[model samples]
Target: MNYNKLVKQKRVIIERCFGQMKCRFHILQYVCRIKLENVPKIIIACIVLHNVAKSLGDPDFELVEQDPDEDEGNHENDELPLRQLGQQINKKKLEYYNK
Candidate 1:
């Protein structure tokens, strides 16, 4: 049934979209603490900004490439782990990455 191509077409593209979103706005990279009703508004705003940036040809703010073998859930996201947080940052950098 050509399942490999099917998976690539569906999952890969979707993940890439999400990865791009995270790389761009960064706020989507983690869980949100906002009210449920406000979540959609914030997402919509980010989408609009994303489209505008794409249209304007903004420089890509890349942090890392999407590794196919990378574990999406590798980090202990229920709480922040030490390494992913920049080693050189001060106490002022304690805010969430997506914040």
Candidate 2:
């Protein structure tokens, strides 16, 4: 089994899960402005709420659609550099895997 392939697939699944979670629970999108010491508690509360809502099969409370034309140019402009970097990183990982 290819470890790199397994890792990449796992990363994609994790991202999709987080995306669904955020879309379903818009309240979790914002950071709580509590004291530093209470930050962990705030995070735990948000996670508990998210899980309860998910278990209840609730629809997304907030879903915003992006304008198709707004970032049309930005996508092409940014993608090339990112693709190159990703390729480089993957190549290095492949080398490590082969070693």
- Output the lDDT of residue 61, model 1: 52
Error of 2 at 59 (Å): 2.0
Query: Residue-wise lDDT of candidate 2 within 4-56, one digit each (tens)?
Result: 99999999977766676677555456775668898677657766766655554
**Clashing residue pairs, backbone N/CA/C < 3 A, model 2:** none
Listed in order, each prediction's TM-score against the native is: 0.51, 0.46
Which candidate leads the pack in TM-score? 1
**Model 2 misplacement above 4 A:** 21-31, 60-99
Error (Å) of candidate 2 at residue 36 is 1.6
The CA lDDT of each predicted structure is 0.66, 0.66
